[model samples]
Target: MTVLDQRALNRATLARQMLLDRADLPVADAVAHLCGLQAQEPQEPYVGLWSRLRAFDPAVLSDLLVRRRLVRTHLMRRTVHLLAADDVLAWRTRHDAMLRQRVLGVYRGEFDGVDLDELAAAAREVLADGEPRTNAEIVSVLAARWPDPDRRALGEIVLALVPTVQAPPRGLWRTTAGVRTVALARWLGSDADPAGPDGDDPPGRALVRRYLAAFGPAASADLRAWCGLAGLPAAVAAVRDELVAFRDARGRTLLDLPGAPRPDPDTPAPIRFLPAFDNAVLGYHDRSRIIDDAHRNLSVAGARFVLVDGRVAATWTVDEGVVVVTPLRAFTRAERTAAAEEGAALASFLSEGENHRVRVAAG
Candidate 1:
C-alpha cells in the first residue's frame, strides 16, 4: 500500500476543504458539500463560508435561515450545526440514538429512573402546538411531571429526545438572539423521515460515504470522531470493499473516494482565516494533516486560526478594525506578506468593505 506523508495529506485536505482555492459554489451546495458548519457560534458560519466560497454574501445565509432552506440543530456529535434543511431531515433520524446517548453520558445520574420514551412523548406534546419555545420554557412544561429532576438536565433531555431546530433570528447573520426551538418537522413543514424498521442499511453507512467525500482519505477513527457515533464499524466494513485505501505515516489506514481530489504535496497553499470550530481542523481523529497536535485543542476551544502553507500557523482576533495575528512559529517575510493580504481580505469581508487593517504580531 502507498504511504501518504503529512504534506501529501495536508494538501489533499486543503483541496477537499476548498481552502486550496476559494470555490464559487453556491452557499447551500457548499454547506452540503462540507457536511455542515460548526455553528454553535451563530455568526461564525458567515466567516467560515467567506473563507471557502467566492463572492459569498452573508445575507444569502441569513436568508436561507429565514426561508427555512437551512436549519440549526443538534445532530452530529450532538453539537449545534447549521445544516441544509433537507440534509438534516434525511439524516436526523439516523443520529437519534447517538444524540440521546451523548446527553445521557453527560447527565446520566440526573435522569436515572426517568423513562426517556415517556419523556420524549411529553416533550413532543409541549412542542406540538407549533410555537417556538426556549429550552427553559420547554423544560418548565415538563417540570410538573419530573418535579424532582434537575431543570437543566430535563431541558437537555428534552432537546435530545425531541428533534428540534434553534429557530431564527438566533442564526441570522449579525443578529444576537436567544435560542428558541421548534420541532424540526414544524420548522421544515415536513416530518423527519422515519428510519427503516430493522434499522438495516443504517444511516451511518451514508454518513461514511458523505464523510469520505468531504474529508476523506480518513480512518474509521476519524469518522467516529467527526460524527460521535460509535456503531459504524459495521458501516465501515460494509463499505470497505468500495473504497481506495492508503496508509498514513502513522500506519493508520486512510480511506477515500477513488476519484476525490488529492493535490500535489508541494501545491502552493495560500493563507486563509478559519472561523472558530471550523471542521477542517476538528473533523479528523488525526489532525496532523492540517494542524499540529500541540495546537489541536484550540480548534475545539473555539479559537479562530490562520492557515499558512496549509497548516495552522497563528491565532487571530479582531479589535478596532484591525485583524491581529499572533504566530505560533516564526514566518518568512513572504508568509507574513501572504498572511497580511488574506487577513486584510477577511477584515474587509467582516466589516463589509469598510475596514481592511491587519497587524501581524512579532513572533
Candidate 2:
C-alpha cells in the first residue's frame, strides 16, 4: 500500500475542507457539504461559513434559520451543530442511541431507577404544544414527574431522549439569544426516519459515506472520533469494497472515496481563519494532518485559530473591534503580511466595516 506522509495528508485535508480555495457554493449547500458546523457558540457558524464560502453574507445564514432551511441541534457527539434541515431529519434517528448513551455516561448514577422510556414520553408530552422552551423551563416541568434526578440532570436526560432543534434567534448571525428547543419534527415538519441500513453493516452506512465526502481518507478510528459512533466498523467493512485504501506514515490504514480530491503535497494553501471547534481540525482521531500534536489541545479549548500554509499557526481574537493575533511560532515576513491581510478582512466582516485594523503581536 502507498504511504501518505503528513504534508500529503495536510494538502488533502485542505482540499476536502474547502480551505485550499474559497468555494462559490451557497451557504446552505456548504453547510450540507461540511455535514454541519459545531455551533455551541451561536455566532460561530457564520464565521465557519465565511471562511469557506465566497461572498458569504451573514444575513443569508440567518435567513436560512428563519426559513427552516437550516437548523441548530444536538447531533454527532451530542454537541450543538448547525445542520441542514434535511440532513438533520434524515440522520437524527440514527444518532438517537449514541446521544442517549453519551448523556447517561455523565449522569448514570442519578438515573439509576428512572425509567427512561417513560421519562421520554412525559418529556414529549411537555413539548407537544409546539411552543419553544428553554432548558430550565422544560426541566422545571419534568421535575414534577421525575424528581429523583435534579433539575439539571433531568433536563440533560430529557434532551438526550427527545430529538430537538434549538430554535432560531439562538443561532442567528450576530444575534445573541438564549437556547430554546422544540421537537425536531415540529421544526422540520417531518419525523426523522431514514430508510433501513442497505447492507449488513447498519443504518449508519450512509453516514460513513457522507463523512468521507467531507472529511475522508480517514481511519475507522477517525470516523468514530468524528461522529462519536462506536459501531461503524461493521459499516466500514460493508463499504470497504467501494473505497480505496492507503497507509499513512503511521502505518494506519486510511480510506477514501476513489474520486475525492487529493491535491499535490506542495499545493499552495492560503491563510484562512477558522472558528472555534471547527471540524477540519477535530474531524479525525489523528489530527497531525492539519494541526501539530502539541497544539491538539487548542482545538478542544475552543480557540479560534489562524491557518498559515494550511496548518494552525496562531490564536486570534477581537478586541475593541480589532483582530488580535498571537502567533504560536515565528512566521516568515511574507507569511506575516498574508496573515495580516486576511485578518483585516475577517475583522471587517465581524465588525461590519467599523474595524479592519489587525494588530499582529511582534514575535
Candidate 3:
C-alpha cells in the first residue's frame, strides 16, 4: 500500500476542492462538482463559490435559485445545503433515513407515542396544496394533532419526514429572508427518485463516486462523516473494485478514484478565503490534510478561514464592510502580502466592488 503523507494529502485536497487554482467552471457545474456547498448561513455559498470559481457572479446563483435550477435543502448530514436541483432530487431519498434518525435523536422522547408514518402523511397533507409555509406555520397547523414535542422540534421533524426545500429568496445571493419551505416535488416540478429495489442501493454507490471525486483519498470513516450515513460501508465494499487505495500517515486506508487529480505535494497553493461551514475543511473525518488538529474545532465553530499554503492559518470576518483577518499564527512577509491581495478582492466581491478595504491584524 502507498503511504500518503499530510502534504501530499493537502495538495490533493486543494486541487480537488478547486482552491489550488481557481476554476473556470460555470457556477452550476462548480456546485455539482463540489457535490454541494454548506449553506446553513444562507449567504455563505456565494463566498465559497467566489473562492473557487475564477469569474463567479453572485447574481447567477441567485437567479438559479429563482429559476429552480438550484435549491436549498436539508441533505448530507441533515444540515442545510445549496445543491443542484437535479442532484437534490436524485439524492434526497437516500438520505431520508439519516435525516429522520438525526431529528428523532434530538426529540425522541417528544415523539414516544407518535406514529412516524402517520406524522409524515399528516404533514404531506398540509403541503399537498403546494403552499409554502414557514416552520412555525407548519408546526402550528400540526399542534392540535401532536402538541407534546417542542414546536421547534416538531417543525424540524416534519421537514425531515416530508421531502421539503427552503424556497427561493431564502438562499438568494445578498438577499436576507426568513426560511419558507415547499414540498420538494412541488418546488422542483419533479419527484425525488425512489430508492433502488431490495438488495441494492444505487444512490449510495453514486454518492461514493461523487464524494471521492471531490473529497477522496479518504477513509470509510471520512465518507460516513461527510454524508452522515452509516449504511455506506456496503456501498464502499461494492465499489472497492472501482477505486485505488493508499494509506495515510495514521495507517488508515484511503480510497480514491484512479483518475482524480492528486497534484504534486509541493504545488504552490494560493491563499483562499473559505466561508463558514465550507466542506473543504468539514468534509473529512480527519481534516489534517487542510487544517491542523489543534484548529479542528474551528471547522465546526462556523469560522470563515484563510488558507495559507493550503492549510488554515487565520480566521476572517467582515466589519463595516472591511475584510478583517486575524492570523492564527505568524505569517511570512510574502504570505501577508498575498493574504492582503486576496482579502481586498473578497471585500470587493462582497460589497459589489464598492469596498475593498482589508485589515490583517498583527500576528
Candidate 4:
C-alpha cells in the first residue's frame, strides 16, 4: 500500500548497490552479494570492484581465480559472469534451461533434428579429461557428429548444454588471455544441486532474497530480467509472506526484504565509475531508479558510464593512460569536479598509479 517515489527508489538502489558509500566488504563477498558481476569483458570486474570495495586489491581477485574460489561462467541470461565457485555450482542447474533456450533461439534452425542430450553427453566426453579447451577446439571435436551448426554456435550451444566455466587467466586482473573452459564439476569438484525440494527449481527462493538484497525494491518483472528465469513466480509467491511491498511511482508493485536498508530519498550519492554491463544498471526491467528511460539503451550498449549524483550522467573509457569522460548532458561545476576527481583515481588504479590524467569532453 505504501508508495515509493523515483528518488526514494533511486537512493535505495545506490545503497543496495554499495555505490552510496564504498563498502569495506571482502571482494569475494561483494561479488556474491552483487549476484556476480557481468564479466564478459574480463578485466572490467577489476574496475567494478575498485569502485565498490574499500582497499580492493586486484591481486586478491586474481588469487580467487587461481584458487578456484571464483569462476567465470555462462549463467544468468546466458552471458558470461564472474561468480563464486560455490554460487556457480549451486545456481548453474537453475539457469541451465534459460541458457539452453537463449542459445537455441539463436541457433535453432541449425540445430534442427539434433538431440540436445546426446550432444551434451558427447561434449562432456571431450571435457572429461580435465583439460581446458577453447570454443573452437570443442566445436572442432564435435564437428564430425554435428557439422551443421557453425563452429561458433556449436561451441556456444555446448557451453550452454553442458555446465562449463572459462578457466583461469581469462579473468585475472590486468591480465589479457583467451577464454578456455572445462567442466564446471571438474573445476568445482562437485555437481550442482539437482533441484529444489519444492520442485524443479534450485534456489529460486534464495535467489529472490539475494537479488533483493543487491537490487531490490523491485518488481517481479525486474527479478525475471535480472536472472532470466520465468519459473520464479512460485518462488516469489512462496516467499510473499516474508516480504514487504511498496508501489513505485508508475504503480508497479515493488517487493523488498523488510530489514534491507532503504536510505532517505535525499541521501547524497558520490560520483562513481561503472564497468561495461554493470549489473546495477542492467539488473532490472524498469531501470529508472539508476538510469533515465531515454538513456536506458546505454546499459546494454556496453558503454562504461560515470554516475553523477547516483544517476548516469556521462560515458567514460580509458584510452592509453588517460580517463576520458563524455557527458551525456551538461554538468554543473561541482559535478564536473567530482567526475574529474573520480576519473583520476580510476585511471591511477587501472594504470598502476603511473597515470592519473583525466580529460572531460565538453558537455
Q: Write candidate 3's Cα lDDT for 1-363 as tens digits.
A: 999999999999899999999999999999999999999999999999999998899999999989989889999989999999989988999889899999989887888889989999999988988888888888888989998888988998998899998997798877889999899998888889998853587888999999999998899999999989988877888899999999999999999999999999988999999999999999999999999989999889999999999999999999999999999999999999999999999999999999889999999
Q: Let me know the TM-score candidate 3 reaches against the reference structure.
A: 0.99
Model 1 error, position 89 (Å) = 1.1
lDDT of candidate model 4 versus the reference: 0.91
Give Cα-based local distance difference scores for all models: 0.90, 0.89, 0.92, 0.91
Candidate 4 vs. true structure, TM-score: 0.98
**What does candidate 1's lDDT look like per residue over 173-289, in tens digits?**
778999998998888889887776433655667788999988988999999899888877877887889899999998999999899999989899989899999999989989998
**Better candidate number, 1 or 4, judged by lDDT:** 4
Q: Which stretches of candidate 3 lie over 4 Å from their true place?
A: none
RMSD of 1: 1.3
Pairs clashing within candidate 4:
none
Model 1: lDDT of residue 59: 95
Question: Ranking by lDDT, best first?
Answer: 3, 4, 1, 2
Stretches of model 2 off by over 4 angstroms after superposition: 194-203
Q: What global local distance difference test value does model 3 have?
A: 0.92
- Model 4 C-alpha lDDT per residue in residues 217-275, reported as the tens digit of each score: 99999999988988898889888899999999999999999999999988899999999
The pairs that clash in candidate 3 are: none
